[model samples]
Target: MNKIHYLMNREVNYTLSKCFLTRLTGWEEVPLVKTDACGLVLFRFNNDFTGLRFKLVLNDIEILTAAHIHLGMRGENGQVVAFLFGPVTRGISVNRGVVTGIIVESDLTGPLQGMSLLELARKMEIGNSYVNAHTENHPNGEIRGQIKRF
Candidate 1:
């Protein structure tokens, strides 16, 4: 292929491979909490899929403590594979806000320990992963949503 054609194809592939989105709700949490708390998370994978940039926005949540990407199917609680917000020393009061971060191989834990970020991406692509947010009132998890391609 010509240089221009190759570059065009590369750009298209990069955009197509990059995004995943999820909508979090208290109802999705295991044991189902009764709260209006909800949120959305967006994951943008790098071109090589070796890492990702994530943005999480929460609404009506209180005393937010932590957020993470867990490895599991919907309606199941799973081990944390990556942290998006603090497993903070203390909960931070929040009504609505955003958390942003980048995750790479080194940031992985639990079942993903020592694995490449691509492994995580593969699991997420298959709907075997989720994003969960925790609060002081629900330390186990206040809200959650399964990750899926955008």
Candidate 2:
């Protein structure tokens, strides 16, 4: 069965290490990093699900910032897929057909709207790649995710 695993501290580190320049500046925040960057947090997902973005509603098409899902480790192929959920247009199907949901950091109030783990590839799912600034730049900075066990 497909597993939709949310982003975790461990997974965030995995993506940062790949960036040749991330180590020096640290994996903190690279101001200029948009949801469009190669990594998960770099840029927003196609509809939002591809990155660590959050989902606002289940039945309707809505998304929020702050994706909880973490980018996974790269496999033999760095496969990435963007599953975005924008406002539905006229002549479009709703409440039924597959309407890709954008990932976001909303609370339990919001849930994913599109492809499940079984439907998508391992590397294409949403992962942690959210940043605060828009134009700021990182010369070796990074955004770290800390984890504590109970």
Compared with the true structure, all predictions reach lDDT values of: 0.89, 0.25
Provide the lowest-lDDT 10-residue window in model 2: 17-26
Please provide, for model 2 over 2-74, each residue's C-alpha lDDT reduced to its tens digit, 9 standing for 90 to 100: 2324445335434432211111112333232223222222222233233332222212111222213223231
lDDT of 2 at 93: 20
Question: After best superposition, candidate 2 residue 30: deviation in angstroms?
Answer: 11
Model 1, span 1-150: residue lDDT tens: 699997885665554447899999988899888888899999999887677999999998888889999999998989999999988868887678988889999999999999988778878878999999998989999999999999
Best model per TM-score: 1
The collision pairs in model 1 are none
Q: All candidates' TM-scores? A: 0.87, 0.18
- Clash totals for all models, in order? 0, 37
Give the distance in Å from residue 82's predicted Cα in candidate 2 to where it truly belongs. 7.7
Superposed on all Cα atoms, the candidates' RMSDs to the truth, in angstroms, are: 4.6, 15.3
